[model samples]
Target: MGTDNRIQTIEESTVYGLYHHGELIYVGCTTLALKRRLCFHRSDASKGNDAPIYGYIRKHVDAPKEDLEIRALDYDTEAAALQDLGHKTLNAQAADGAEYEGYDWTSEEIDVLEEESLNEASKRLDASFNQCRRAAMKLGLIDGDGAYTRVDWSVWDEALGTMSDPKLAEKIGCSVANVNERRRAKGIEAYQSRLSDDKVRAIWTRYHALEEATYASVAECFNVSKGTVARIIRKETYQDVERPPRITIEVAKRYHAQKDKSTDKGRILA
Candidate 1:
């Protein structure tokens, strides 16, 4: 079929092709209005996306919009669009009508990631540990020995002595084994949460007193994990701390069900 260049009105839920200098370069399907989807493509490209299509768009960014001849067709799904477009364009991966797997990090992004702790970098850059590590190695920022050069264990003694190996490992962005090896060398025991006995008793009291007081909320309030709050409620760790009388555990259990149901409903709505 020949390219249709006369259409000016772009409707919703269609497949579109972006052509530059009469050469087909990219094919995409969007449930949003075609005009809005095209705007998004331009925006992402301007923001330095690493995809082939975005890279092409960046090259022609200063040119007139009509230069990239957008052709749209009414298509039900991306697979249908791919079948029609003949899979010859520059798509980063196969589109089975779901979220794209994997991402390509820019060199600048990897450089910034290498400066932060593993956990901090992962959250800040929205890249996994393995992803950051791989990008660093690919950019020649780290040596091929697989050893992370960013961590400094000299100042980690206090944390190593007080926190659990797993928790410390997560906070400092290293492996649990590494934390364990360091702690054992210093003759430190496993983490016993440093929350005081008074704080422990307060967590139990708050859980039974408030209908909205979940293990999570109580933990956040006291700066501890939900698991630690559960252990407190069950009198597992702080057996010395006593619960206030007439406070039934069944109340907390009922609220837990309510919280879980609301969370699930929110996910479905989203």
Candidate 2:
């Protein structure tokens, strides 16, 4: 049908053709209200084919909306509405033209799958690369090449003695997965948390005794987090009390006009 046959206005329950400069940019049928669909086409959504069109409308802050036209079209069937919707048509290619065809594997193709990588075999047999890969995996053809890539672990082990995991990953030209595998094999812990019940008990005891114990003071005393102190005191009843969220500047000043926390007498014992 010619472009002249297209309707100028949008109608309810109609198959719409969105045009830009008289070329059909998109085609789709919406049973919902056409007004809502129009709004949805500009709703800052990046789903599929419409993503680029909506993105352009959003990005060009000064562009005129008048340039594009949304018009109703005539289609005898629902299938016709989708058949000619977009600028380009997607059609299936011949079996030989592509590396894959919808072919069930014979016993022969299945037997020699482990001979090479899935890609190389697919090219040789002129089959679908994805299908061949699936078949290979099911038939245990995936193990022809050993799973591990051999690297000199001696250098990596030496580096691991002093260097961090991230730095070691870069140096060995492998991923963090390999680095972690080496650590696990060598019985090396990534990071050992040094927190103990004895330390927590001491901190809690000292904080409960001192009325002037601020989170900063308790944190400095035990070298632990202020949040940890707050959680222990407020949630678990460490001090049987908790301080206000913020101490008044006057109370803090009365406690100490200026105190250096680095020194021993900076805070109230705790």
Candidate 3:
């Protein structure tokens, strides 16, 4: 019964060709089989017509042997098998042609696979966001006033740390625009204060040539719209009108005289 089962399995199995150095070394396939392909490769006699495959195996026997790995192609679909085969062919070509040397060649292949994986992951993320938005709408998380639940700043911080704006906004039960508006509002006071201080210092530090640093230039540095920058400069509370408190010769003389009189009075009292 076991022998009959093994024969039945082999008759129904699908095999793939393995290539080495761009040469077809073996032609075989598998189903839910008893032995792995690598196991066959390791034990098979390298005589007669299988001389080339045997020679290839012999060349690697003494060298540091890399493990043979199998990846599942779509088991029952021709298109899936072809796609996986193409990827495998490219990887094998790269490996045999010294395209990958010294480093982990398998890791490079896996990196390529990971990039393809991310595309699906990104699509799923977007789909999840849409589902959440719909559910939130049903739950009355969004009111008739067009205002959704206010995103906690802490949630925003965590979301920003891990996810993109659209994803974060969806997770936080708000629109992307609302998220941005909240972020700006949260920092507006500090941003405005910094800009105001920077503008005042710019004018003060370059008092000799205040025209050199224009409102437009400062605006660019602060990343605000040019019109906003112009408004900031125009409404700047600290102006160039009050020059730094000056120490004139007359004032200095008066101050010295006062100091001398005070010292003389103290000495006399002592």
Please provide TM-scores, in order, for all candidate models, with all chains considered together.
0.29, 0.23, 0.24
Instruction: Report model 3's TM-score to 2 decimal places.
Output: 0.24
Tens digit of per-residue lDDT, candidate 2, span 4-93: 211111112456666656666556555333433454554443343345555555554233245555566797433465566533412121
Sorted on lDDT, highest at the top, how do the candidates line up?
1, 2, 3
Best by lDDT: 1
Ranking by TM-score: 1, 3, 2
lDDT of 3 by residue, 201-247 (tens): 44333322333566666556656556555534454333322333334
lDDT of each: 0.63, 0.50, 0.42
What residue runs in model 3 are displaced by over 4 Å at the alpha carbon? 1-122, 125-131, 136-146, 152-173, 185-213, 217-228, 231-270
- Candidate 2 residues lying further than 4 Å off, grouped into runs, are 1-12, 45-50, 56-64, 76-78, 88-270
Give lDDT: candidate 2, residue 106: 53
Give me the overall lDDT of model 2. Answer: 0.50
Off by over 4 Å in 1: 1-12, 60-64, 84-87, 98-270
Candidate 1 global Cα RMSD: 21.9
lDDT of 1 by residue, 26-110 (tens): 7777544444445567668879889988887777546625556666756766677667675677877557653323445554555
The better-scoring model by TM-score among 2 and 3 is 3
Best by TM-score: 1
